[model samples]
Target chain A: MADEPRKIAFICSKGNLDMAYPALIMGWAALGNGVDVTIFFTFWGLDLINKARVDHLEIPPVANTSMKMSMMGIPGNLGIPNIMGVLPGMTAFATALMKKKMNELGVPPVREYIQMLADAGAKLYACKMTVDMMGLKKEDFLDGVQDIVTASDFIDMTEGAQIIFI
Target chain B: MPTRTYAGKTVEVNEEGFMLNPADWTKEIAVEIAKEEGIETLTEAHWKVIDFCRQAGLASGKAPTLRTITTGAGVPTKELFTLFPKGPAKKVARIAGLGKPEGCV
Candidate 1:
Protein backbone atom coordinates (compact mmCIF):
# COMPACT_ATOMS: atom_id res chain seq x y z
CA MET A 1 0.00 0.00 0.00
CA ALA A 2 1.48 3.38 -0.91
CA ASP A 3 1.53 6.04 1.77
CA GLU A 4 -0.49 9.20 1.37
CA PRO A 5 1.13 12.23 -0.23
CA ARG A 6 2.78 14.65 2.22
CA LYS A 7 0.90 17.60 3.71
CA ILE A 8 1.90 21.23 4.27
CA ALA A 9 0.14 23.89 6.34
CA PHE A 10 0.89 27.59 6.26
CA ILE A 11 0.00 30.08 9.02
CA CYS A 12 0.16 33.70 7.93
CA SER A 13 -0.16 36.34 10.67
CA LYS A 14 1.08 39.55 9.09
CA GLY A 15 -0.67 41.55 6.33
CA ASN A 16 2.08 43.65 4.80
CA LEU A 17 2.51 43.36 1.05
CA ASP A 18 5.91 41.73 1.53
CA MET A 19 4.74 39.34 4.24
CA ALA A 20 1.95 37.95 2.06
CA TYR A 21 3.87 36.64 -0.96
CA PRO A 22 6.03 34.10 0.85
CA ALA A 23 3.04 32.09 2.04
CA LEU A 24 1.21 32.32 -1.29
CA ILE A 25 4.24 31.27 -3.32
CA MET A 26 5.01 28.36 -1.01
CA GLY A 27 1.44 27.12 -0.99
CA TRP A 28 1.47 27.13 -4.77
CA ALA A 29 4.68 25.10 -4.78
CA ALA A 30 3.31 22.60 -2.32
CA LEU A 31 0.35 22.05 -4.59
CA GLY A 32 2.77 21.59 -7.48
CA ASN A 33 4.46 18.82 -5.54
CA GLY A 34 1.11 17.01 -5.19
CA VAL A 35 1.12 17.78 -1.48
CA ASP A 36 -1.97 18.69 0.48
CA VAL A 37 -1.67 22.40 1.30
CA THR A 38 -3.69 24.52 3.74
CA ILE A 39 -3.21 28.17 4.66
CA PHE A 40 -4.75 29.92 7.71
CA PHE A 41 -4.96 33.67 7.69
CA THR A 42 -5.21 35.21 11.15
CA PHE A 43 -5.43 38.80 12.42
CA TRP A 44 -3.89 41.14 9.88
CA GLY A 45 -3.09 38.24 7.58
CA LEU A 46 -6.83 38.04 7.18
CA ASP A 47 -6.42 40.91 4.76
CA LEU A 48 -5.15 38.45 2.20
CA ILE A 49 -8.57 36.81 1.94
CA ASN A 50 -11.01 39.61 2.60
CA LYS A 51 -13.10 39.97 -0.55
CA ALA A 52 -13.53 43.71 -0.26
CA ARG A 53 -10.03 44.62 0.81
CA VAL A 54 -7.61 41.82 -0.03
CA ASP A 55 -6.72 43.45 -3.30
CA HIS A 56 -5.95 46.74 -1.57
CA LEU A 57 -3.25 45.49 0.84
CA GLU A 58 -0.52 48.07 1.17
CA ILE A 59 3.21 48.44 1.80
CA PRO A 60 3.83 50.88 4.60
CA PRO A 61 7.40 52.17 4.55
CA VAL A 62 7.30 53.68 8.03
CA ALA A 63 9.68 51.85 10.35
CA ASN A 64 10.40 49.37 7.57
CA THR A 65 14.13 48.63 7.54
CA SER A 66 14.35 47.11 4.08
CA MET A 67 12.25 49.78 2.40
CA LYS A 68 14.36 52.52 3.98
CA MET A 69 17.57 51.06 2.64
CA SER A 70 16.08 50.50 -0.79
CA MET A 71 14.66 54.02 -0.91
CA MET A 72 18.14 55.46 -0.39
CA GLY A 73 19.52 53.16 -3.12
CA ILE A 74 21.88 51.64 -0.57
CA PRO A 75 22.71 48.01 0.04
CA GLY A 76 19.97 46.18 1.97
CA ASN A 77 22.32 45.68 4.93
CA LEU A 78 22.77 49.45 5.35
CA GLY A 79 20.07 51.13 7.43
CA ILE A 80 18.76 54.62 6.67
CA PRO A 81 18.20 57.19 9.42
CA ASN A 82 14.86 56.82 11.25
CA ILE A 83 13.67 60.24 10.08
CA MET A 84 13.74 59.16 6.48
CA GLY A 85 11.27 56.28 6.91
CA VAL A 86 8.88 58.83 8.48
CA LEU A 87 8.78 61.22 5.60
CA PRO A 88 5.38 61.95 4.04
CA GLY A 89 4.73 60.08 0.75
CA MET A 90 7.50 57.59 1.67
CA THR A 91 4.96 54.80 2.08
CA ALA A 92 3.45 55.50 -1.31
CA PHE A 93 6.82 55.65 -2.98
CA ALA A 94 7.89 52.42 -1.35
CA THR A 95 4.66 50.73 -2.29
CA ALA A 96 4.89 51.89 -5.87
CA LEU A 97 8.45 50.67 -6.24
CA MET A 98 7.73 47.22 -4.84
CA LYS A 99 4.59 46.90 -6.97
CA LYS A 100 6.55 47.88 -10.05
CA LYS A 101 9.26 45.33 -9.45
CA MET A 102 6.76 42.56 -8.90
CA ASN A 103 4.99 43.51 -12.11
CA GLU A 104 8.22 43.39 -14.07
CA LEU A 105 9.03 39.95 -12.67
CA GLY A 106 5.64 38.65 -13.93
CA VAL A 107 4.42 38.07 -10.39
CA PRO A 108 0.66 38.53 -10.17
CA PRO A 109 -0.78 41.17 -7.90
CA VAL A 110 -2.46 40.11 -4.63
CA ARG A 111 -5.94 39.32 -5.91
CA GLU A 112 -4.70 37.27 -8.87
CA TYR A 113 -2.13 35.48 -6.74
CA ILE A 114 -4.84 34.29 -4.37
CA GLN A 115 -6.93 33.23 -7.34
CA MET A 116 -4.02 31.26 -8.72
CA LEU A 117 -3.47 29.51 -5.40
CA ALA A 118 -7.10 28.54 -5.27
CA ASP A 119 -6.96 27.43 -8.87
CA ALA A 120 -3.99 25.23 -7.98
CA GLY A 121 -6.09 23.60 -5.21
CA ALA A 122 -4.44 25.03 -2.08
CA LYS A 123 -6.97 25.37 0.74
CA LEU A 124 -7.45 28.84 2.22
CA TYR A 125 -8.97 29.54 5.63
CA ALA A 126 -9.79 32.48 7.83
CA CYS A 127 -9.37 32.52 11.62
CA LYS A 128 -12.72 32.31 13.38
CA MET A 129 -11.41 34.24 16.36
CA THR A 130 -10.29 37.10 14.17
CA VAL A 131 -13.57 37.03 12.30
CA ASP A 132 -15.57 37.40 15.51
CA MET A 133 -13.22 40.06 16.81
CA MET A 134 -13.53 42.05 13.63
CA GLY A 135 -17.27 41.38 13.22
CA LEU A 136 -16.68 39.89 9.81
CA LYS A 137 -18.93 37.40 8.07
CA LYS A 138 -17.95 34.46 5.91
CA GLU A 139 -19.16 36.44 2.95
CA ASP A 140 -16.45 38.95 3.71
CA PHE A 141 -13.86 36.55 2.38
CA LEU A 142 -13.11 35.67 -1.21
CA ASP A 143 -14.45 32.55 -2.93
CA GLY A 144 -11.50 30.24 -2.19
CA VAL A 145 -11.63 30.17 1.63
CA GLN A 146 -12.44 26.67 2.80
CA ASP A 147 -13.91 27.86 6.08
CA ILE A 148 -13.44 30.08 9.07
CA VAL A 149 -11.88 27.76 11.64
CA THR A 150 -10.76 28.19 15.23
CA ALA A 151 -7.07 27.91 16.08
CA SER A 152 -7.61 24.59 17.82
CA ASP A 153 -9.46 23.22 14.81
CA PHE A 154 -6.66 24.32 12.54
CA ILE A 155 -4.09 22.59 14.75
CA ASP A 156 -6.11 19.41 14.72
CA MET A 157 -6.56 19.50 10.96
CA THR A 158 -2.84 19.98 10.39
CA GLU A 159 -1.82 17.04 12.55
CA GLY A 160 0.91 14.90 10.92
CA ALA A 161 1.45 17.64 8.38
CA GLN A 162 4.49 19.90 8.25
CA ILE A 163 3.46 23.31 9.58
CA ILE A 164 5.06 26.54 8.46
CA PHE A 165 4.34 29.86 10.19
CA ILE A 166 4.84 32.95 8.05
CA MET B 1 31.31 9.84 -11.48
CA PRO B 2 27.64 8.68 -11.39
CA THR B 3 25.80 7.99 -14.66
CA ARG B 4 22.71 6.27 -15.99
CA THR B 5 22.48 4.68 -19.43
CA TYR B 6 19.17 5.31 -21.16
CA ALA B 7 18.28 4.88 -24.84
CA GLY B 8 21.79 3.54 -25.49
CA LYS B 9 23.37 6.79 -24.24
CA THR B 10 25.29 6.87 -20.96
CA VAL B 11 24.71 10.33 -19.49
CA GLU B 12 25.76 11.96 -16.25
CA VAL B 13 23.03 12.07 -13.63
CA ASN B 14 22.88 13.27 -10.07
CA GLU B 15 22.49 10.99 -7.07
CA GLU B 16 18.72 11.38 -7.43
CA GLY B 17 18.88 10.40 -11.15
CA PHE B 18 18.25 13.78 -12.78
CA MET B 19 20.38 14.29 -15.88
CA LEU B 20 23.37 16.52 -15.08
CA ASN B 21 23.16 17.86 -18.63
CA PRO B 22 19.60 18.51 -19.76
CA ALA B 23 20.75 18.74 -23.38
CA ASP B 24 21.40 14.99 -23.26
CA TRP B 25 17.66 14.34 -23.15
CA THR B 26 15.61 12.90 -26.01
CA LYS B 27 12.18 11.30 -26.38
CA GLU B 28 13.73 7.89 -25.95
CA ILE B 29 15.53 9.07 -22.83
CA ALA B 30 12.21 10.39 -21.47
CA VAL B 31 10.62 6.98 -21.94
CA GLU B 32 13.53 5.27 -20.20
CA ILE B 33 13.56 7.81 -17.35
CA ALA B 34 9.81 7.49 -16.84
CA LYS B 35 10.10 3.72 -16.57
CA GLU B 36 12.83 4.08 -13.96
CA GLU B 37 10.47 6.27 -11.91
CA GLY B 38 7.88 3.44 -11.67
CA ILE B 39 5.79 4.72 -14.52
CA GLU B 40 5.78 1.69 -16.82
CA THR B 41 4.37 3.80 -19.61
CA LEU B 42 4.23 7.50 -20.37
CA THR B 43 0.71 8.25 -21.57
CA GLU B 44 -0.47 11.23 -23.57
CA ALA B 45 -1.34 13.09 -20.40
CA HIS B 46 2.16 12.53 -19.12
CA TRP B 47 3.68 13.77 -22.37
CA LYS B 48 1.49 16.86 -22.21
CA VAL B 49 3.07 17.76 -18.89
CA ILE B 50 6.62 16.74 -19.90
CA ASP B 51 6.39 18.69 -23.12
CA PHE B 52 5.14 21.75 -21.25
CA CYS B 53 7.92 21.53 -18.66
CA ARG B 54 10.62 21.15 -21.30
CA GLN B 55 9.34 24.11 -23.24
CA ALA B 56 9.05 26.25 -20.14
CA GLY B 57 12.55 25.27 -19.01
CA LEU B 58 13.95 26.17 -22.40
CA ALA B 59 12.23 29.59 -22.34
CA SER B 60 13.03 30.44 -18.72
CA GLY B 61 16.44 28.76 -18.37
CA LYS B 62 15.15 27.14 -15.19
CA ALA B 63 12.59 24.60 -14.17
CA PRO B 64 9.02 25.86 -14.02
CA THR B 65 7.48 25.55 -10.60
CA LEU B 66 4.40 23.32 -10.28
CA ARG B 67 2.33 26.46 -10.33
CA THR B 68 3.54 27.34 -13.81
CA ILE B 69 2.70 23.91 -15.22
CA THR B 70 -0.82 23.92 -13.81
CA THR B 71 -1.54 27.44 -15.03
CA GLY B 72 0.56 27.48 -18.18
CA ALA B 73 0.05 23.91 -19.28
CA GLY B 74 -3.65 23.86 -18.38
CA VAL B 75 -3.35 20.62 -16.46
CA PRO B 76 -5.52 20.86 -13.38
CA THR B 77 -3.91 20.14 -10.03
CA LYS B 78 -5.77 16.88 -9.41
CA GLU B 79 -4.78 15.50 -12.82
CA LEU B 80 -1.15 16.41 -12.19
CA PHE B 81 -1.10 14.29 -9.03
CA THR B 82 -2.76 11.45 -10.85
CA LEU B 83 -0.25 11.64 -13.69
CA PHE B 84 2.96 11.98 -11.67
CA PRO B 85 1.87 10.73 -8.24
CA LYS B 86 3.93 11.67 -5.19
CA GLY B 87 6.76 14.17 -5.66
CA PRO B 88 5.21 15.32 -8.91
CA ALA B 89 7.44 18.33 -9.44
CA LYS B 90 10.65 16.45 -8.76
CA LYS B 91 9.55 13.49 -10.86
CA VAL B 92 8.49 15.67 -13.77
CA ALA B 93 11.69 17.70 -13.57
CA ARG B 94 13.83 14.61 -13.61
CA ILE B 95 12.00 13.03 -16.54
CA ALA B 96 11.80 16.33 -18.38
CA GLY B 97 15.54 16.84 -17.93
CA LEU B 98 15.39 20.03 -15.90
CA GLY B 99 16.76 21.14 -12.58
CA LYS B 100 14.79 20.55 -9.40
CA PRO B 101 12.34 23.33 -8.71
CA GLU B 102 13.36 25.37 -5.66
CA GLY B 103 11.42 26.25 -2.46
CA CYS B 104 8.73 23.89 -1.20
CA VAL B 105 8.48 22.12 -4.58
Candidate 2:
Protein backbone atom coordinates (compact mmCIF):
# COMPACT_ATOMS: atom_id res chain seq x y z
CA MET A 1 0.00 0.00 0.00
CA ALA A 2 1.36 3.46 -0.93
CA ASP A 3 0.82 5.00 2.52
CA GLU A 4 -1.12 7.70 0.56
CA PRO A 5 -0.69 10.50 3.06
CA ARG A 6 -3.68 12.84 3.05
CA LYS A 7 -2.74 14.92 6.04
CA ILE A 8 0.52 16.86 6.32
CA ALA A 9 2.02 18.71 9.26
CA PHE A 10 5.06 20.95 9.51
CA ILE A 11 7.02 21.95 12.60
CA CYS A 12 8.97 25.07 11.90
CA SER A 13 11.63 25.53 14.57
CA LYS A 14 14.03 27.90 12.83
CA GLY A 15 13.48 31.59 12.31
CA ASN A 16 16.08 32.37 9.66
CA LEU A 17 14.86 33.49 6.24
CA ASP A 18 16.23 30.46 4.40
CA MET A 19 15.30 27.98 7.11
CA ALA A 20 11.69 29.17 6.94
CA TYR A 21 11.04 28.64 3.21
CA PRO A 22 11.33 24.85 3.17
CA ALA A 23 8.39 24.31 5.50
CA LEU A 24 6.47 27.19 3.94
CA ILE A 25 6.90 25.97 0.35
CA MET A 26 6.10 22.39 1.25
CA GLY A 27 3.07 23.49 3.25
CA TRP A 28 1.85 25.58 0.33
CA ALA A 29 2.33 22.62 -2.00
CA ALA A 30 0.32 20.36 0.28
CA LEU A 31 -2.54 22.87 0.25
CA GLY A 32 -2.38 22.88 -3.53
CA ASN A 33 -2.87 19.13 -3.38
CA GLY A 34 -6.14 19.53 -1.50
CA VAL A 35 -4.60 17.81 1.48
CA ASP A 36 -5.18 18.84 5.07
CA VAL A 37 -2.18 20.88 6.20
CA THR A 38 -1.03 22.38 9.49
CA ILE A 39 2.04 24.30 10.56
CA PHE A 40 3.28 24.67 14.15
CA PHE A 41 5.63 27.59 14.65
CA THR A 42 7.87 27.37 17.72
CA PHE A 43 10.78 29.34 19.17
CA TRP A 44 12.46 31.47 16.51
CA GLY A 45 10.29 29.96 13.81
CA LEU A 46 7.58 32.14 15.31
CA ASP A 47 9.16 35.02 13.42
CA LEU A 48 7.92 33.37 10.28
CA ILE A 49 4.35 34.28 11.16
CA ASN A 50 4.94 36.90 13.84
CA LYS A 51 2.71 39.94 13.31
CA ALA A 52 5.51 42.50 13.15
CA ARG A 53 8.61 40.51 12.14
CA VAL A 54 7.77 38.10 9.32
CA ASP A 55 8.65 40.35 6.42
CA HIS A 56 11.83 41.45 8.20
CA LEU A 57 13.17 37.91 8.68
CA GLU A 58 16.85 37.65 7.86
CA ILE A 59 18.78 35.04 5.87
CA PRO A 60 22.36 34.61 7.02
CA PRO A 61 24.53 33.88 3.99
CA VAL A 62 27.26 32.67 6.33
CA ALA A 63 28.15 28.97 6.00
CA ASN A 64 25.60 28.48 3.23
CA THR A 65 27.01 27.14 -0.03
CA SER A 66 23.62 27.40 -1.68
CA MET A 67 23.53 31.18 -1.44
CA LYS A 68 25.43 31.78 -4.62
CA MET A 69 26.27 35.38 -5.43
CA SER A 70 26.39 34.17 -9.02
CA MET A 71 22.65 33.60 -8.93
CA MET A 72 22.26 37.36 -8.66
CA GLY A 73 24.12 37.74 -12.03
CA ILE A 74 27.44 38.45 -10.39
CA PRO A 75 29.02 35.83 -12.68
CA GLY A 76 31.71 34.65 -10.29
CA ASN A 77 32.46 31.92 -7.79
CA LEU A 78 33.87 34.37 -5.28
CA GLY A 79 32.18 32.90 -2.24
CA ILE A 80 31.68 35.17 0.74
CA PRO A 81 34.27 34.30 3.33
CA ASN A 82 32.95 32.61 6.48
CA ILE A 83 34.42 35.52 8.43
CA MET A 84 32.44 38.03 6.40
CA GLY A 85 29.25 36.13 7.22
CA VAL A 86 29.63 37.38 10.82
CA LEU A 87 29.98 40.99 9.72
CA PRO A 88 27.12 43.48 9.83
CA GLY A 89 25.19 44.15 6.59
CA MET A 90 26.10 40.66 5.30
CA THR A 91 22.80 39.25 6.49
CA ALA A 92 20.78 42.06 4.97
CA PHE A 93 22.65 41.76 1.70
CA ALA A 94 22.05 38.04 1.57
CA THR A 95 18.37 38.44 2.42
CA ALA A 96 17.86 41.05 -0.26
CA LEU A 97 19.59 38.94 -2.89
CA MET A 98 17.73 35.79 -1.96
CA LYS A 99 14.39 37.58 -1.93
CA LYS A 100 15.09 39.10 -5.34
CA LYS A 101 15.91 35.72 -6.88
CA MET A 102 12.79 34.20 -5.36
CA ASN A 103 10.74 37.09 -6.73
CA GLU A 104 12.21 36.50 -10.18
CA LEU A 105 11.12 32.91 -9.91
CA GLY A 106 7.60 34.06 -8.94
CA VAL A 107 7.86 32.90 -5.34
CA PRO A 108 6.03 35.17 -2.91
CA PRO A 109 7.78 36.79 0.03
CA VAL A 110 7.59 35.11 3.45
CA ARG A 111 4.65 37.15 4.77
CA GLU A 112 2.60 36.75 1.59
CA TYR A 113 3.44 33.06 1.33
CA ILE A 114 2.28 32.43 4.91
CA GLN A 115 -0.95 34.29 4.15
CA MET A 116 -1.38 32.26 0.98
CA LEU A 117 -0.95 29.04 2.91
CA ALA A 118 -3.53 30.10 5.47
CA ASP A 119 -5.89 31.31 2.76
CA ALA A 120 -5.58 27.92 1.13
CA GLY A 121 -6.87 26.36 4.37
CA ALA A 122 -3.55 25.34 5.87
CA LYS A 123 -3.95 25.71 9.62
CA LEU A 124 -1.35 27.38 11.84
CA TYR A 125 -0.60 26.50 15.46
CA ALA A 126 1.65 28.43 17.80
CA CYS A 127 3.50 26.19 20.23
CA LYS A 128 2.31 26.81 23.79
CA MET A 129 5.60 25.83 25.38
CA THR A 130 7.51 28.29 23.27
CA VAL A 131 4.80 30.91 23.57
CA ASP A 132 5.09 30.88 27.35
CA MET A 133 8.86 30.59 27.24
CA MET A 134 9.13 33.66 25.08
CA GLY A 135 6.32 35.50 26.85
CA LEU A 136 4.33 35.86 23.65
CA LYS A 137 0.63 36.50 23.47
CA LYS A 138 -1.87 35.31 20.91
CA GLU A 139 -1.93 38.85 19.56
CA ASP A 140 1.75 38.48 18.65
CA PHE A 141 0.75 36.21 15.82
CA LEU A 142 -0.74 37.15 12.48
CA ASP A 143 -4.39 36.55 11.79
CA GLY A 144 -5.50 33.03 10.80
CA VAL A 145 -3.48 31.18 13.45
CA GLN A 146 -5.78 28.40 14.55
CA ASP A 147 -4.55 28.11 18.15
CA ILE A 148 -1.77 27.85 20.68
CA VAL A 149 -1.06 24.17 21.25
CA THR A 150 1.12 21.84 23.32
CA ALA A 151 3.11 18.90 21.91
CA SER A 152 0.32 16.51 22.79
CA ASP A 153 -2.20 18.75 21.14
CA PHE A 154 0.00 18.85 18.07
CA ILE A 155 0.19 15.05 18.05
CA ASP A 156 -3.60 14.91 18.06
CA MET A 157 -3.85 17.43 15.25
CA THR A 158 -1.23 15.51 13.25
CA GLU A 159 -2.92 12.15 13.50
CA GLY A 160 -1.99 10.06 10.42
CA ALA A 161 -0.34 13.02 8.78
CA GLN A 162 3.24 12.95 7.56
CA ILE A 163 5.06 15.29 9.92
CA ILE A 164 8.11 17.22 8.80
CA PHE A 165 10.22 19.07 11.34
CA ILE A 166 12.36 21.97 10.15
CA MET B 1 17.35 -1.32 -19.88
CA PRO B 2 14.54 -3.06 -17.95
CA THR B 3 11.21 -3.85 -19.62
CA ARG B 4 7.72 -4.97 -18.75
CA THR B 5 5.17 -6.75 -20.93
CA TYR B 6 2.27 -4.41 -20.24
CA ALA B 7 -1.05 -4.93 -22.01
CA GLY B 8 0.60 -7.63 -24.16
CA LYS B 9 2.85 -4.91 -25.59
CA THR B 10 6.58 -4.72 -24.89
CA VAL B 11 7.50 -1.40 -23.26
CA GLU B 12 10.70 -0.23 -21.60
CA VAL B 13 10.68 0.73 -17.96
CA ASN B 14 13.05 1.37 -15.13
CA GLU B 15 13.72 -1.14 -12.37
CA GLU B 16 11.41 0.85 -10.13
CA GLY B 17 8.63 0.59 -12.79
CA PHE B 18 8.59 4.08 -14.32
CA MET B 19 8.14 4.04 -18.07
CA LEU B 20 11.43 4.80 -19.83
CA ASN B 21 9.59 6.22 -22.82
CA PRO B 22 6.19 7.66 -22.01
CA ALA B 23 5.03 7.49 -25.65
CA ASP B 24 4.40 3.78 -25.09
CA TRP B 25 1.41 4.62 -22.88
CA THR B 26 -2.19 3.87 -23.81
CA LYS B 27 -5.49 3.35 -22.02
CA GLU B 28 -5.13 -0.41 -22.38
CA ILE B 29 -1.71 -0.21 -20.70
CA ALA B 30 -3.26 1.75 -17.85
CA VAL B 31 -5.89 -0.91 -17.33
CA GLU B 32 -3.23 -3.60 -17.10
CA ILE B 33 -1.09 -1.59 -14.73
CA ALA B 34 -4.08 -0.78 -12.55
CA LYS B 35 -4.89 -4.45 -12.34
CA GLU B 36 -1.31 -5.19 -11.34
CA GLU B 37 -1.72 -2.66 -8.56
CA GLY B 38 -4.89 -4.51 -7.32
CA ILE B 39 -7.24 -2.02 -8.86
CA GLU B 40 -9.43 -4.49 -10.75
CA THR B 41 -11.64 -1.83 -12.24
CA LEU B 42 -11.18 1.64 -13.67
CA THR B 43 -14.40 3.60 -13.57
CA GLU B 44 -15.15 6.94 -15.29
CA ALA B 45 -13.96 8.80 -12.22
CA HIS B 46 -10.70 6.94 -12.41
CA TRP B 47 -10.29 8.05 -16.02
CA LYS B 48 -10.79 11.66 -14.99
CA VAL B 49 -7.99 11.39 -12.48
CA ILE B 50 -5.67 9.53 -14.85
CA ASP B 51 -6.29 11.93 -17.74
CA PHE B 52 -5.70 14.90 -15.52
CA CYS B 53 -2.44 13.43 -14.21
CA ARG B 54 -1.15 12.70 -17.69
CA GLN B 55 -1.86 16.22 -18.88
CA ALA B 56 -0.29 17.73 -15.80
CA GLY B 57 2.75 15.48 -16.13
CA LEU B 58 3.17 16.63 -19.72
CA ALA B 59 2.97 20.28 -18.72
CA SER B 60 5.42 19.90 -15.86
CA GLY B 61 7.69 17.49 -17.78
CA LYS B 62 7.64 15.25 -14.72
CA ALA B 63 5.35 13.14 -12.67
CA PRO B 64 2.65 15.20 -10.97
CA THR B 65 2.72 14.85 -7.21
CA LEU B 66 -0.41 13.79 -5.29
CA ARG B 67 -0.92 17.43 -4.38
CA THR B 68 -0.71 18.42 -8.04
CA ILE B 69 -3.38 15.90 -9.04
CA THR B 70 -5.73 16.91 -6.23
CA THR B 71 -5.23 20.64 -6.80
CA GLY B 72 -4.91 20.78 -10.57
CA ALA B 73 -7.07 17.75 -11.38
CA GLY B 74 -9.80 18.95 -8.97
CA VAL B 75 -10.21 15.58 -7.32
CA PRO B 76 -10.82 15.56 -3.60
CA THR B 77 -8.39 13.65 -1.37
CA LYS B 78 -10.93 11.11 -0.16
CA GLU B 79 -12.15 10.37 -3.67
CA LEU B 80 -8.59 9.99 -4.89
CA PHE B 81 -7.87 7.45 -2.15
CA THR B 82 -11.07 5.57 -3.05
CA LEU B 83 -10.22 5.63 -6.76
CA PHE B 84 -6.52 4.82 -6.72
CA PRO B 85 -6.33 2.97 -3.41
CA LYS B 86 -2.79 2.43 -2.12
CA GLY B 87 -0.09 4.78 -3.40
CA PRO B 88 -2.34 7.00 -5.48
CA ALA B 89 0.44 9.15 -6.92
CA LYS B 90 2.78 6.25 -7.70
CA LYS B 91 0.05 4.09 -9.16
CA VAL B 92 -1.46 6.89 -11.20
CA ALA B 93 1.89 7.86 -12.66
CA ARG B 94 2.74 4.28 -13.62
CA ILE B 95 -0.64 3.83 -15.28
CA ALA B 96 -0.36 7.20 -16.97
CA GLY B 97 3.14 6.27 -18.27
CA LEU B 98 4.96 9.01 -16.41
CA GLY B 99 8.03 8.58 -14.24
CA LYS B 100 7.42 7.54 -10.65
CA PRO B 101 6.89 10.73 -8.69
CA GLU B 102 9.93 11.57 -6.54
CA GLY B 103 8.52 13.35 -3.47
CA CYS B 104 6.04 11.89 -1.00
CA VAL B 105 5.68 11.00 2.67
lDDT top scorer:
1
User: Tens-digit lDDT track for model 1 on B1-105?
Assistant: 699889999999888777888899999999998888788899999999999999999888788877678879999766887788756888899999988875342
Clash pairs detected, candidate 2: A33-B67
Model 2, span A1-166: residue lDDT tens: 3655499899999999889899887876565444678999999999987888898988887888766657667888877678888898988988888888777666668887776666556789999999999888999888878789998999987889898999
Model 1: pairs clashing at backbone N, Cα or C within 3 Å: none
lDDT of 1: 0.83
Going through the candidates in order, their DockQ values are 0.44, 0.07
Where does the lowest 10-residue lDDT sum fall in candidate 1 chain A? Answer: A66-75
TM-score of 2: 0.61
What lDDT is reached at residue B2 by model 2? 85
List ranges where model 2 is wrong by over 4 Å: A1-11, A24-40, A51-56, A60-68, A79-93, A103-124, A133-147, A151-165, B1-10, B32-49, B56-61, B65-89, B102-105
lDDT of each: 0.83, 0.81
